[model samples]
Target chain A: MSFALQLFDLVGIFVFALSGGVLAVRQRLDLFGVLVLACATAVTGGIVRDVLIGAIPPASLADWRYLATAMFAGVVTFFRHGSIERMRNPVLMFDAAGLALYAVLGTGKALAFGLSPFAATLLGIITGIGGGIARDLLVARTPVVLQQTELYAVAALAGGGIVAIAHALGWPQAPAMAVGALLCFGLRFGAIRRGWRLPVARGTDSDS
Target chain B: MSFALQLFDLVGIFVFALSGGVLAVRQRLDLFGVLVLACATAVTGGIVRDVLIGAIPPASLADWRYLATAMFAGVVTFFRHGSIERMRNPVLMFDAAGLALYAVLGTGKALAFGLSPFAATLLGIITGIGGGIARDLLVARTPVVLQQTELYAVAALAGGGIVAIAHALGWPQAPAMAVGALLCFGLRFGAIRRGWRLPVARGTDSDS
Candidate 1:
């Protein structure tokens, strides 16, 4: 079980790191900036969750595997950015897959740590989106999560809520997590394919 | 000692929150956004420090006083922004005060947590600047800390380093902390007054 969890975490980290590295490349940041963003995006959310839950030193810092995965992703993205840019759809799919896994795993971890269901759900969404937010911030841009029309945060909330509910209902862990991940991935994929967007606020009278 | 620490924390939170609120008003964010940015700016640094050191739930979340301070600052800023804007120098002074206090407090806490001197110093700087970075990010701006001309991070590092060094030298905790704070405040205050700036990186041939 631990090995499987580790594998899942590594894959998620790799994909997230790649996204960060690609962004850094686009921004024309130095090599150091690219690696820093990759590592931060890959692990910062988990680190934030661990800290909030009182997990000291965070698994990302304590365990070298996570760092290694981020570095590997950054290197690959740096060298093959041209080809990777051409494969935008595949990259987006990978990002969605990572988001789904992170949401489920984050909720599960928060639940294990005795967080309230509401808090756990929030943490799960944070885990899914926190790294991306951090990445965008470093590059001086608004986070995509905050933008209207993206189903990112909404999908994370849904997936996290499902995990929390399943745990509350005494559902088996593995299958429950799987279902949560699938739901998150499906929603995100559909949003991308259909260009779905949430409604924006109409201009208030004060604006005019 | 605990009471004094709490008082210091509250003051810092108030000042930071005020800065955030003022920024929000300038950005034309609604009331909710103002409050969110205020609270985020005031508490994020300490939260980041607590998490890094394995302090659970974060003092900001655990203590209602911190939240109240943030809200109070936000409300005041929202209603009296014109006057607050006129008091720009005072606000900058308050921000410097907050930065000094946070740097000293953060280093002290990290040292208490048994972190190495280098790590503790870094944490102190993070505690000083983290909230501001968070504030800028939420508003979709480049962090002032990363700006080439800003001496903000440099001042933080110096103050934090003093605290760590004093601790390493077996100085009395209270006096050592006081000295660290004073140094940070003086440096920051001087920088603002004199328009001191760090050197920017020279443009490379690749740029041309």
Candidate 2:
């Protein structure tokens, strides 16, 4: 990976780890639980993607930097949660940045792994949302991605789809990735600002 | 994998799928949710172990049999849930069978992957409990494995540890696996029968 890509990924991991740690505190998880959630949320997406694409020992496990970054985020959140919680907008901004970057990065990685465009796109979405899903699961909550309360998965899919299309068209990787990330960020940021939600499934009982 | 191992794994997957489907039904999830949970619970453990051990495309993904078995179990539960729910003993029996089989099977697979005995043992325990954890998470409940209500992880660890030790000692695979399975089954069954529980962590707030 290029230095730019590595830096982007590290930033994403740190932000995601912070989000996970914050959630852990809200859930009243112990210190161990906080760290576990933080690390799981920060790296599980990439791990799942890498595993599916036949990359063994996942980057998260092979490289100590990722683990250290996650742990650092966890410890920081543990002590400074009160102050952090008050800066909700900045936190949400960081989360959006991470989400956007992960969507494109995951798609790019899957392509590099020689997956079909469709499969690569799917993997990219998984890489974007997988961490949050794992974190919510650990805390015993329905995953936010599955909920009809936001455009999270839609944004991810959009980013991943863009990357896949670009790859298929033999477009330059750097520009393609940048455009995809921007699109994802724009959609997610708009949804957060406007409180947008996807239409939920109607009640089966009422239909019956 | 030998025919015997294949058969054992199929049985475990079927049983675990049934448990997942049943849980989804109880949670009032739709048919899609039921199938999703069934597949997730049946395959996640093996997938995790394979990924960690550098076995890509996971056995669960590479082999169609695993998917077929899980889907069949889910469909059966969807149709026969009323009758199935009435037979509590059978459900518990199946779960125990799965738990026992997965523990040893996972350990053996890890050893085959050339992982260290300790890592293999950990993977085995993960394989035993990972499915149920995914099932509970999907339904928005705390994982039963992590709770203090039973000797679940302990039983798995015992079985896995036994297999690791036997392998390290150059014991024949068949006898070693049989012994591990029996030990796991016995411990899990005994815990269920006697209502045995691990001690809960005392509340910290009171101490503070």
Candidate 3:
């Protein structure tokens, strides 16, 4: 395994766990419930992605690293939730970066499995946003992805497409990953700053 | 499908949708959000179960009835939120029944597809519990299945095991399905009524 890739995965899981932990505290969930939500948000995406890619006994179950990282993050958040909540914006930015990293990684993995680009991109988005979706669904609400303001999905798409482009051009792995991450962060931050969004059709099916 | 089975399927879908809709309204979500949640809970499991079982395009995507039933239930719930909330117990009972019916149907489908008994039972549980899990996860809560609960998993197991046993005995479809459904409801309702619970290990492994 690439050390850099593994580092990115660890960071992604940690950040997502932090996000889930913050939300759990916000919702006033008990300790076990907090851990449960944190784990769900931190690991569900990669597990689903791996399963869909036909990686049996998903990475979440096979490798101890992801679970350990998520659990550690959850525990850390449990003790430092107040401080973490006060730094919400910065934490969200970190989460966005993690989302980008995961999106690129997921798409790359899907492509490696010989899926079509369309399917790969879809998997990338799913891998990127699925954790948050699962997190939201557990709490009984519409996912952040479907909301008008959240640029979460856009960031994933941009990062995934960039990875695909670099792959087409035969870029080295390091350069491709770096560019993909940059594109993802750039698009995500830009969307947040500029209020960019996909238009929801209001009155007509044709608009969609 | 047997007419009785088809009828129960429709009822189950509607009840599931109602539960979703009520929860959405309680959360102060918009109409579209309510509809999405309702539809997702009502059909996403069967859709996923079908796709995983290699039923191309999936039943949810193919059948308009499922969508219509869910959407209508959502609409009705939106307009009658107060009344529906007042009848929460009855609604829950319906939801439980839906769980039984869905589990049996899903198990039967898995068995027909030649999956092993273990796998079929798992698929049945997934099919039965999956929608609620998805719904809860979207709302950012830990799913009930993963939490300390009385016999939800066991209920799905019973239903699936019944189907497997009946298949092993060369029983016809209808009787097998009935047996499975009854087993599920019996286990689930019994647990609920008796407050039966499985013991959780104490914090011997804080690391776990």
Candidate 4:
């Protein structure tokens, strides 16, 4: 991965870990539990992606930096959890950013694995949302991905599509990545700011 | 794949789903979130095991029964959540049983895939704990597997090892599976009852 891409991934992991830590604190988990949650959120998606694509030893296990980053973030959050609690919108904002970054990075990695563009895009969305889904399941909540909230998957698709198109047109990898990331970030932030959401089915009269 | 084994798998899934549903209620999750968590906890480990062993489509999506079982449990919990809350210890005991069942099943499936016994045993542990790990991460808590609790992994290892040994001895598959499952449950139950625990290392003075 390019240095900038790597940087983005690191930052994304940190942000996601922070979100996990904050949520753990909110749930009154002990320190160990909080740290585990942070690490799981930060690394689980990449681990799943690598495993699916047959990357032996999986980057999450091989890369010490990712673990260290998550560990540091978890510790910081554990010690100063109250500040995170005070930020009412922190989880939403951080999770959105992490999703955008991860979606782009995952798509880019899929392309690197020589997958079809559509498959790459789909994998991107999966990678972006998979960890959170895993985390939510552990915490016994519905994952945001399945909720009728803003079009999170749509935003991931848009980002992945942008990267795929750029790559098809022979754009440099860096530019392609940037375009993907910007698209994801912009769409997610816009959705959050404007409260954009997909329509939900109305219950029938007979529905309880 | 034996009828008896399949029956146990279905029972394990059902009990596990019930535990997951109880957790959802305890967490005060909404209906959708509760169902998602229940299904995920009930099936994600098997899904991961199948995917890792290159079992096409994975069991979660291939067999409708697993999804139906989990969803039904979720709905039941929604309607009779009060009953679940009143039976906390039973719910936990069932969850522990499911963990052992999944672990053995996963190890057996991996072995059937022609993986080495060692790998199969490892896969069994993963399958056993993976769903709960995923569940915890989603809810932003530490995974129960990594906690300082009873000898969870030790139970999986014992069960998986017994299966491998039975295979080596050319024992009948049905008996072998039963042995494996029984070993796991027995050891786990023993640990719970006797308060068996692994030793933890304190931080070094240099670090302090």
Candidate 5:
């Protein structure tokens, strides 16, 4: 990865960890639990993506930067949770940025590894949502990505699809990735501000 | 990776799937949800093990039989829910058998892959509990492995430790694996029969 993208990844991981730490505090998890949830939420997506593409040990385990960033975020949030929760909109925005970057990055990596477009796109979506799903599960909550009204995964899918399409067309990667991330961030921002959401299933529970 | 071990792995996966299916039914999940939970719970342990050990695509995803067995178990449980629920003790026993086998198998694989004994033993414990943890998390329940006084992981740890120790001593694997599995199964069985449990922390909530 380029230095710029790698830097973006650390920022994203830090924000993700902070959000997880906040949730852990709210759930009354002790310091150890908070750290676990924070670190897990920050790295699970990347680890899963790397594993799928045959990257051994994963970046989170192989390098100290990602884990240190997560731990730092966790500690900060643990100490300043009340203030952080009060700035929910900003946290969500940062989370959207992280999601966009992960989706784009995962897609690019998969394509570079010779995965087909369909598989690459799917893996990208997994990368974007994997961490949040893991964090929610650890807290015994239904993942927000699976919620009827959430638009999280769709935004990720769009970002991943963009990167995949760009790669398929032999387009310049850096610009395409930037555009994809912007689009994802925009979608998430719109969702938060305008209540944009997926249609809820209206089917009867008896049959399903 | 031998034929016998592969067959044993299939049996373990089948039993694990059945347990997950039962849980999904109790949760009132739909057919699709039941199948997903069943398959996920059956394969998660192996997948995590493979990913950690740099095994790509994972044997569970690579082999169609693993998925088919999980789906078949889910379907059987869906149709025979009442009968299966009636055989509670038998189901638990099967689950224990699965756990024992996974612990032994995971340790053996890790050791074969040139991991340190400590890491191998840790991976083995993860392999035994990973599926069940995923199953519980999916249903929005706290994982049983983290529950106070549950002896599940300790049992797997013991089993894994045995294999690790044996490998360290340059002993033949087959006999050591069999002994480890037996010891694990016995521990679980004894725990069930005699209320065996680990001690709980008695520290004040104010401090931790």
Candidate 6:
């Protein structure tokens, strides 16, 4: 990744960690618990992506910057949670930004690892959602991604698919990534503001 | 791993998948949902272990047999759920057995990848509980391992610690693994049957 992209990755990790830390504070978990959730939420998605691509000791584990950034976010959130709680649904924008970056970046990495384009795209989607799922599960909240609310998965797929398609066509990385990220963020932002949602299964009482 | 260990791995996957399948049926999830949960439960731990150790395309993804076994378990559970439900807390035994196998195997694999014994032990514990956690979270159950009512994490730690210690002492792998698995299963069984519990943080009304 370019220096610009690497910087964006840290930013994404920071915001995602903030969400985890805020949740821990709301749950009244101790300092250690806050830090644990923060770090786990920030790193899990990338860790899963790296692991699948055979990258040992994932950047989250091997590179101190990733964890350091998470801890910093955690400590800050711990002290400033009152301000955060006062904000209106603060984590949503952070999540959309992180999702967009992760989707594109994860797709790029998987392609670099020689995965098939389809597999890489799927991995990208997983990368986008994995951390959020972990954070929600840890805090005992039902996963919002699985809840058929907003166009979360659709936005990620759009971002990841753009990267994969660009790669197959030998397009320049920076431009492709920029457009992909913008599209993902736009889609997610629109979905949130305009109420785009997938139609869930009907007939609540029906089952196999 | 040796042939016997590999066979046990399959058995572990089967039993764990059975738990997921049973849960899905009880929850009245559709057939696709049932298979998804079953496969997710069966393969998540090994996938995490392999990813941490730089194993590409983790066996759960690379090999067909692991998924085949899980699917088989899911299909059987779907059909025989009446019989399974008739049994007494059957999934508890299956979970303990799977936990024991995963802990030892995960530890051994981590060591083989040259991680420090402490790190390997921790990884082993994560591997033991990872699948169960995923299964519960997907179905909106509080993670059983995180609940203070059970000795799940402790049993996994003991089993993983034994494997790490045995390796550090240059003990034979086969015997060490057998003993480790037995110890883990025994501890978990006793904990569940005897209602052993961990101390929970008091004063639920308190906040930071």
Q: Tell me the spans in candidate 2 whose CA falls farther than 4 Å from its real position.
A: A1-47, A54-125, A131-140, A146-208, B75-80, B194-208
Q: What C-alpha lDDT, on a 0 to 100 scale, does residue B204 get in candidate 5? A: 23
Better of 1 and 2 by TM-score: 2
lDDT score for residue A205 of model 6: 52
Question: Per-residue lDDT for A1-208 in model 5, tens only?
Answer: 7788789999999999998887777766655456667888998998888888887766675566787799899888767776787899899999999999999998988998899988999999988999999888887888888986679999999999998888889899888888999998889888988999987667757667
The residue-level lDDT of candidate 1 at A153 comes to 76
| Tens digits of per-residue lDDT for model 3, B8-96 | 99999999899889888988889998998899889878876775566767787798999999999999888999999999878878887
All candidates: CA RMSD in angstroms?
A: 6.8, 6.9, 8.8, 9.0, 6.8, 6.9
TM-score of the B chain in each candidate versus the native B chain: 0.95, 0.94, 0.92, 0.90, 0.95, 0.92
- Candidate 2 vs candidate 6: which has greater lDDT? 2
TM-score of each: 0.61, 0.62, 0.57, 0.57, 0.62, 0.62
DockQ score of each predicted structure, in the order shown: 0.17, 0.16, 0.11, 0.09, 0.15, 0.14
Estimate candidate 1's alpha-carbon lDDT, on a 0 to 1 scale.
0.85
Q: Per-residue lDDT of A64-161 in model 3, one digit per residue for the tens?
A: 57767887887777777667867878887888889988898888988898887778877888899999987777666788887987778888888887
**iRMS of candidate 3, Å:** 8.5
Over all chains combined, what TM-score does candidate 6 have?
0.62
Model 3 CAPRI quality: incorrect
Worst 10 residues of 1 chain B by lDDT: B27-36
Models ranked on DockQ:
1, 2, 5, 6, 3, 4
Q: Could you list the iRMS of every candidate?
A: 5.4, 5.8, 8.5, 8.4, 6.0, 5.0
Candidate 1 clashes: the total is: 0
Question: What tens-digit string does per-residue lDDT give for candidate 1 at B1-208?
Answer: 5887778778889999999988877766655456667888998999899887988777776565777799899888877877887899999999998999999889989999999889999999999999999998887878888896568988888889999998888888888888888888888888889888887668854786
Q: If you score just chain A, what TM-score does every candidate get?
A: 0.95, 0.95, 0.90, 0.90, 0.95, 0.93
Candidate 1 chain A worst ten-residue window by lDDT = A199-208
Candidate 2 CAPRI assessment class: incorrect
Docking quality class, candidate 5: incorrect
